[model samples]
Target: MKNLSVFSLFLVINISAVFSQNHYGKNGMVASASTYASQAGIEILKAGGNAVDAAIATTFTLAVTWPFAGNIGGGGFMVIHTENGEVTTFDFREKAPFASSKDMFLDKNGKLKSGSNHNTALAIGVPGTVAGLYDAHQKYGLIPWEKLLERAIQLAESGFPLPKSLANDFFQFAEAPEKYPEMQSFIKRDGKVVGFGEDWKQPALAETLKKIQKEGKKGFYEGEIAEALADYIQSQDGIITKEDLAQYEAIERSPIQSTFKGYQLYGMPLPSSGGVTITQMMNMWEQLEETPIIGSVQYYHILAEIMRIAFRDRAKYLGDQDFIEIPELEKLLSDEYATELLEGINFDKAGESTVTEIHSIHEGQETTHLSVMDANGMAVSMTTTLEQGYGVKMQSPDLGFLLNNEMGDFNAVPGKTTNNGQIGTPANTIEAGKRMLSSMSPFIITKNNYPFLVIGSPGGRTIINTVFQTILGTTVYDYPMAQAIEAPKIHHQWLPDRIIYEEYKMAPETLKALEAMGHEIQMRSFLGRLMGIKYNAETEFMEGAADSSSPDGGVAAY
Candidate 1:
């Protein structure tokens, strides 16, 4: 494994070419929604940190620079593929508190209660970010933990220039303080929201980081911090307790393993519907009638049709592995099942839509993703979220972070599948200490026993589809990392059955072709904010791309 010193490392952070999605590095590279955080990770890589070390640092830094989804109060998944070809995943996704119930979100008539799942402190699941990062570093990190916290603590104490989008969010919350009682700590310092371009510092968050640096996970999950979290949530009608916080631990799980066209794939498994769904989709693509042509109408049609079927299975079969047994999981990932699934598809016309109207549960699109690859070839793809943007828009004045409304990810009503894309399956029903299902698909692809790509995205239900298409585009269609990342994405979760495409991104003729195929179409401003790195074996360099849809994203490499 080769290492580079900060002063000698040739860092390449080209803001000018970010729109083009072109950035490359010989030793290591990182991509994220925030240029500030990505750059900080690059500095760590240059200072001889491994990918896991840089990823940990980047996650903390995001908690500061991109608080909407980047957070210690939230939880996420991490995928790592070592240079030796071994791969594993970490599941730090939030869990239901011990006091939660299967019918907590239901009313007197057993009907879904509006806002119960996401608009209150009761929606906050016990957080796992601290435990997750600590676990990953303890296993694979080369840099010290305290060193990783330094940048984030400094960023919080000194602050950074406020980006316009973030500034606008604070302004909206500040317009009526009584409407959002807790968000004032973030933007209002003297009763005024921090204006765009001003330095916005968080003194409390810095102190929190310092505690974490000194005492590790206990700094966050025990003693003072833990007491504040439990007492505050209880005060807000939530069920979280200090016991739940202390018992929380990030799990190391086997990644969903599969192969497509000679390339090996490693994806986040179980609690996250991502790995299984993507693995199934990729395996199914191998059984397609013809090779997929990158932007053809036929290509988009095939992806949509496959996604429709896969998502149906997702609604029926996926959940926390710890809670229920998915007997057919092995069979689902089998190549034979993929071939069997193609039997129902009518590429010429369209299969009957299956939008089962039931209890609707959507993971928030505001989640953030980051990718990192150190010089030694340790590649990481991580996705973290706060359920919906500001996450219930609830924050603790003492903790200095927003709490995730992640409990919304659970099926709200049992045994009531509907046509509105609701999945009321018992597997995902609310339960004490159960991890809610997720669509995050952080993954790594390897070619000939070496790292080929590290990729993931933030688009809620669209995540699995986005990841599958990126792999298909880059590996089979021969597209570059940037082109695949910049390409318009297609998504069709089984329940919606409506084909969702990025607005104005598809060719006019292609859109018409899909419509003629009898598929209903919907338009979105964008689908996912993808951040990824693709390896070039011939040149020994890695090419990176950050989603240009979000103006603040960038790639930093050395």
Candidate 2:
């Protein structure tokens, strides 16, 4: 059967129709890429599920009902803080198959294959997303698993118009139909990509959801689903065997903790570069009350310099702890190290350094981030992905979930540059069962003994910069939840040292000044999505906000 392309579906979302479905006025907020997905979660909360339950429902629903960025076949990182003060980090990151080896993409001549030419089947890591969701439900979900999935299944079966955000993504990905044939059928109509307001549905995906509801995770890993996944991977020349799916498991790990201005911050540890990089940046800025004041060139310059130094360490030391040494990370984020790095910053000029050299310059690794908080105080900050837009652009008929190309995130050549413009580093090379280093940084801030802020973002290397700016927006600039999330953002990722500023809000004169001082300026089509909640412990009141640019952005309170 020929797969449909975005051009052929002629699909487009009717914004008015989607928005008219429901409202999230108060009590428990859900943020996703689309309104249907958010509504799916809000309905769960209305039906008596707690925040964790709502989040669980929303995640699964997004997997089947929204296919651009998430699915059961992908992997993700989640940070959960319970109402009673228990904090746990779930590392459901994808893992390499046992057959994988370092430099798997390198030829006998010692040349690396182009990023586009890398093996798809060989890059499929053992997916832990479904198992991780199940684990979260078992530990914290108040509703029955089947009940939660039912909502998603209903949405998948009945079908809905593609949301404007998803419609935009479909057109954006239409250029490379061969790489992402899975998106073809959904986005195409008359052999062309569909425009906005068109209807879209995945009946096969709906059936897969029903199977999961009836047979639990086994429906995905053991019976028909498992066989389908194996066959699909085999057809694609992928390395994922049935044993990989059956043996996959999600693990709970302790979050890395740090204190900034009396607020305790918790985030995922190594393998997730977010925790360390964020800690380092925060520590550098902790003493900046007298320094980077908002709207000042000195402040922005100082922060950019700090980002340069921290990113230098990030590229070298951050990786899966099981496969590498991460002991230095904790010590590196200490006050002493921060002081040493901060002292080197010059308010008058940019600092020159070698912080942008990553093992893989695989550009544009997109993901989705969501934040949930209910009246019970159960909070979850999660970021999940199919790698880039649909995981290798492949779909399995039996499983009905898009497989991730996460292995493509690593260096194909362990010690040399491949056709891509990157110098190979072994720390991030492929290895059997080893997790890839991820930039997903789901995090929370605590005031006193309770959670004060739950926040995260969805950019690859820009993750650290986006998160850093949001923290500054809330803590330094004293912006409310909405203002903090919507504030104009600026980012410098160490490589180009050129500052990329969001248009309209940033001062043009400031941009010119930075450009004169050796900053490269680039414009992004859209700002990264950031969602979070802020708690005022003194008053016992909570406020939440979602990224304004995202159509599904919203905050709820009771």
Candidate 3:
């Protein structure tokens, strides 16, 4: 069976239609990239859990069901808007081990060592998922911590039905055994292609989850699991150590807040380039005197220019704030300052990009996101990832999990900038214990104390733009959650200076207009996978929208 692409789903969503059918019970709802994980969330919610509890349950399940991105071996960010009016964010992004360096990915000749940054064991970052999720659960979860791991443990032990796409992935391992040697967990003894609907079980993974279920985060970071992770990485010439794993801590940060069209948006700040870049773009958009109607050529042209400027700023100024001071953050995110920056934009012509290097240039659009909202009004939006699909493709023989190549996200060389989108910006230079910069944008929007939307997406650098477009589609154009998610989105990172749009989704006339406006256009089969829940004020319902970009994505709600 062929998967249905969002390009083929063109049903319009008026507010009335959204309220009538898309609405779920006020008790809880979940929108995520995996049906298995989304169902896990609904179960937790029904078991007397809040949104945060459901999110924890969903994340661990995704680690089992959507291994390409979700993982206990990787890390991510979580944003929560509690019903009591508190907004908080957690940064569980992966960090460089103590023995890492700035030139680890560079050769003695000062050139990049091909595949070193992302394809080998050295690319692995210290895992942070356990720490991040545990910290959040400790603070706000309504259910017992071990209970969250039950569904994941059961699936890993008894085996869950493999989706078609995952079967295809296993088949690839069968076809190209040499290229995908690390995929041994899925390798069958008979040497045959794996098919969809087959039971996929992992005894080792079940054991690992049981350990966490018994001992909490320590099961992963301090004892047997830690020893296995460190020993395996070291055997592959990697730098992780037990000390690195033990010292890792997830940090709680203040959520970045901004206003657009009278609605307030709360997003993850700093290490994540998502919040700041999106803030800058939105500020510039609000300042534009010639704001065109949605889907117009003028609309795309202006937004691209805005995206270009914001991304250029991202390259030069954004990073782990703990490592460097971003004195420009306050000014840059200010709407008053945006009015000053827009003075240079011609608006009629596309702007040329001057920034040539990017801290996160190597990241691809391979990550997973989950959005959960409970009856109590707690909304959790989370985005987690490895640098690319299957991460470094290094799965531990004992752990049954794939590790992240997040080190590729840091600047690999000092004082080096490239024409092909590599950069050695000081803010993102590799440093022991420093986190790599990211584009994970998990956000919550509110209108006068009412939670309006719990939203987030995963598309590497395109994530920021995807979030921006989703908000525009919903708030500005009044599209329902699904219609907004399926609508075409565009991305422009200053360097590369090209508009990336979903292939064939744009009108011929719109593309021509953008090209004539001095914009260079490129086509991508898809832009992002977004999981969001829109709050219906009139009906008091939560409308969950799971992106159709992935075949197995679903909204598990009541």
Top lDDT: which candidate number?
1
Q: Candidate 2, residues 1-558: lDDT per residue as tens digits?
A: 011211121121122123222223346777665556667788888889887787778788778656767688888888888989888988889888877888677677877665532336676777878778888888888888898888788777776677777778788769777766666765665677766777665677888888888877788878888888887888877778888888877889999889888888898887888888889999988866474445555555666777777776776666788897667876787999888887887767777755335422463456777777776767888888777766676776544567777887776666664323354566677778898888888888877767677788777767768888888777766666666666656776665555666655455555666666666677775457776777665566666666655565554344
Predicted candidate 3 versus true structure: per-residue lDDT over 1-558, tens digit per residue? 001222122322232134223546677899888989999999999999999999999999998998878899999999999989789999999999999988888888988899898888889999899999999999999889989999999998888888988877777767776777777655452454546887778778889989988898899999999999899899889999999999999999999999998888899998998988888888888777765766667677877878887888888888999888999899988988899878878778998875444523657678899999998888999999987988888777688888999999988877887767888789999999999999999989988877888889888899999999998887777777877777777998887879999875676667777788899999998788888899999988888787767668888888
> Which stretch of 10 consecutive residues in model 3 shows the poorest summed lDDT?
1-10
Per-candidate clashes come to: 7, 26, 1
Candidate 3's C-alpha runs over 4 A off are 1-23, 187-193, 355-360
Residue 534 C-alpha lDDT in model 2:
75
TM-score of every model?
A: 0.95, 0.89, 0.95
Can you give the lDDT of residue 45 in candidate 1? 88
Candidate 2 segments exceeding 4 Å error: 1-26, 116-119, 168-182, 186-195, 355-360, 417-423, 537-541, 551-558
Arrange candidates by lDDT, descending. 1, 3, 2
Q: Poorest 10 consecutive residues of model 2 by lDDT?
A: 1-10
